[model samples]
Target: MSLKSERRGIHVDQSELLCKKGCGYYGNSAWQGYCSKCWREEYQKARQKQIQEDWELAERLQREEEAAAYGSTAQAPPGAQPLTFSKFEEKKTNEKSRKVTTVKKFFGASRPGAKKVLGGKRRGDAPEAKSGSPSISRQVSLETDRVSKDFVEFLKPFQKPGQDLYKQCKIFLEHMHHKRELSIEEQSEYAQDFYQSVAEKLQTRWKVSPEKVEKAMDQVEKYVMTRLYKYVFCPETTEDEKKDLAVQRRIRALHWVTPQMLCVPVNEEIPEVSDVVVKAITDIIEMDSKRVPREKLCCVTSCSKHIFTAIRTSKEEPASADDFLPTLIYIVLKGNPPRLQSNLQYITRFCNPSRLMSGEDGYYFTNLCCAVAFIEKLDAQSLNLSQEEFDRYMSGQSGPSSSTSSSSLLPRGRESSCPEGSALALVRHNLEAVGQLSRRQERVEREARRLERDLIEWTEGLGREVRGLVQRCPLRLHPGTPASGTPAAPAVAIDSDNLEDPRLPPPLQPQVYAG
Candidate 1:
């Protein structure tokens, strides 16, 4: 119905203006013919509720689909009722019926009235098996089996001296599969330990010579190392995931020791080198220098130094080779050191510095630091020059322009006017004596202070005990009171012969003054 508004004198349709929910309120244009506030809110609530219901329905349908797809419906209690998937169950039943029907069809076709074929071949024209010729597929399978057997036999020598070869191979392969989880050194140590244990067992059980056992151990280690290197780094093998997994899981190498693993970094900050580590390595190289080439050792040492320096900037463990790869690549690419640049390809291909420096325990870095400290101590022992003078000498900073000779840094005194060599010796001796005296004085002072503190504590403890005893005594011996049941107090006595007693001091003596 059209109504006239008195305020504006405008005609409006009452039915069109009214709220659709019958709220008895005029609808606003903003609400699209519904009450603006309440109807909009109710509409939003309805939409949200519908959306929630749809989402829940979708999730339930997905779960049911997954359950049906996997074909296992026993989800709840020990003996819950099976859920029904009518279409799926029907399909399965139809498949069974179809298979049965096909079998029956085959039997029916074999009836007496049906056309008979010779030897199960249609029309007696099918290809006949030739007795003398093997199929290509059969030949390939036979060849593969033969190769595998031959390979196993080839690896027999690499097994521990007296253990079952097959069993040892299995264990080694399993170890290789998990070896990447540990650092290269740890893996080497483990392999070495295994070799040692096996060798010892064989030595005791088989009465094998120590030298023979060592030789066997070396062969096994070498085989393992070569095999591991090939398996891990080979281009054709490494990319094939299935082959790689199989190799890691089942392939065993005897034990390989590359030059990189054995290389030790040089001391840069100290004049004296580590005698023990350097000497051991030198001895090995001298004994069998061909096995560990000097060039390879040098390259390994250089690469190790670079990696150690690179990682020192960050305390976080490097997650991959990429972390330091860029820096090393830059160094090689820059070509400032022409030799290193020329040999960069060979170094990268053969020597993996990342593997060497990746020890979780930081043994390589620790060893390098120890070597440097040892060298520094040795230089201090032998060199007469001060640290600054030594530094200048090493850096060529004390050339013709510099007035300070190595001996000029010697202690200045009447001894300074002596001959250079003699003065240096004298100064060194004096410094050494002074250092020793200072150390000895510090120790003596410390001992004296400790002794004093102990004496004080002991005296205080004794004083407390004496005071306690005197306070607890009941023999007061007062002149005014008669001594009843209590025994008479002893008279104070002094022993002149024992004047050295610790308790003889007048201040420490207990008073027996009558009140």
Candidate 2:
């Protein structure tokens, strides 16, 4: 055949002119020269079918593996939609970025600075720093049982069995105090609002019921009333205020007394504390008066004395020294002393040893004995100097009877106010002779003189400290304004003293209690 005819004609025997697989199909005369129409169709169909089957089998295996791992074939909800930018879109974005990176790598391979210019990570995938606030997981941990233990420990002293409601009550009171300065009437209104808020907080934050919150608040109020009755000066309500006309009473009693405004409670007798505790407390007062702020020192000293008196005369013994010690220290460290002085003075009538001793079944006798012993001990300790030195000290000091500005703050009036004919005055005179050692008739006079000197000198020193403290931290009732540098006590108007019953008998002798 001619060469041109041979190129165009089919050659059956020549494999090069036929399909490469020799499938009895004519070759296409293309680059691979593999197969012709019919045979190429069958071959393509078989390969495509295999590929399709492989893809199906892989998908089936993936589903089975997922079901095995999760123990269920979880599916999206009926109306659930896919995310706007899903993994499929992300995959396309990643592939396109890779292609761009590959092309850039080839083009920039010769340039040393190109690597430095390129981003280390894809911009969209870069990590961001977390915010400064604590995570939700951490926030949730505060309300857990782990934190309850700490709350319980704090409120243990104030808690009743199976409940620590007083902690919540304290929160309410403290919030009111800290919510900016409010006037007396304003404070009352704010306190009522805060009280309600505390109830809600207990119900929500503490998981307490509304009923429990109300009950706890009531208990807290009663406890507060009891405390105000004994310690708070210028309390919101009192027997004296109650006796006034309703309109006047509301106006006067609108004031809110804070925990810091401790006073000897009205119409309440001083409760007795232990002699040991009283002695220790007094020692602290004497030693730290200068180191502690004048206001705190005075308030704590006053509180300690009041507690001592209360423990000495109260029919019931204090729960424990521990119960009062922490609280006492806190008051000493933080109490407002100026307000405390007013409180002490207001209850002077109830604090008379003579009255307590004569009152039916009162423990005033035991109280007086303890107090006398304490005073004697203190007096003996004070007389450590030579007789001449003691005499010199005595000569320079004024007696408690003197009402000089320096000695005015002392609680001396309570003793001196006893009538001349009263047994209380006689007892005082005898107690004044306690430290004497009588030798002969003349020696007795000398001993009495020494005892008197010692008593006067020691008391004078104490009065001086009190006066200094008051000067440094002036009480609210002081007439003149405090010095520019001095810390001023919180101010409240002093109500006029309620007159005592005219027929009431004079306090019996403190000496009678000693007997």
Please give me the total number of clashing residue pairs in predicted model 1.
8
Over all chains combined, what TM-score does candidate 2 have?
Answer: 0.18
Q: What's the distance in Å from true for residue 79, model 1?
A: 34
**Cand. 1 TM to true fold:** 0.23
Given candidate 1, what's the lDDT at residue 169? 46
Which one is best on lDDT?
1
Each candidate structure's TM-score, on Cα atoms with residue i matched to residue i, is 0.23, 0.18
lDDT of each residue in 1-515, candidate 1, tens digit only: 22222222122343544555676554432233344334445545655666676566556655666676556554466575555567655655565445323221221122222334446433212232431245843663465456446546554664554345346645885787676444322344455456545666657865668766655444444334333432233222112233334323221110121111112122222323233223333322232111211233344355445454534423234423223322222222222222221122222222222222233212222222222222223221123335674455445555322123222334446345655466466566678879999999999999999999999999999999989966654233334334685655553434433456575564334577898
* Clashes by residue pair, model 1: 220-254, 221-255, 223-254, 224-253, 224-254, 224-255, 225-255, 225-256
**Which prediction has the highest TM-score against the true structure?**
1
Which residue ranges in model 2 land beyond 4 Å of their true spot? 1-149, 152-188, 196-515
Off by over 4 Å in 1: 1-170, 228-373, 376-381, 399-515
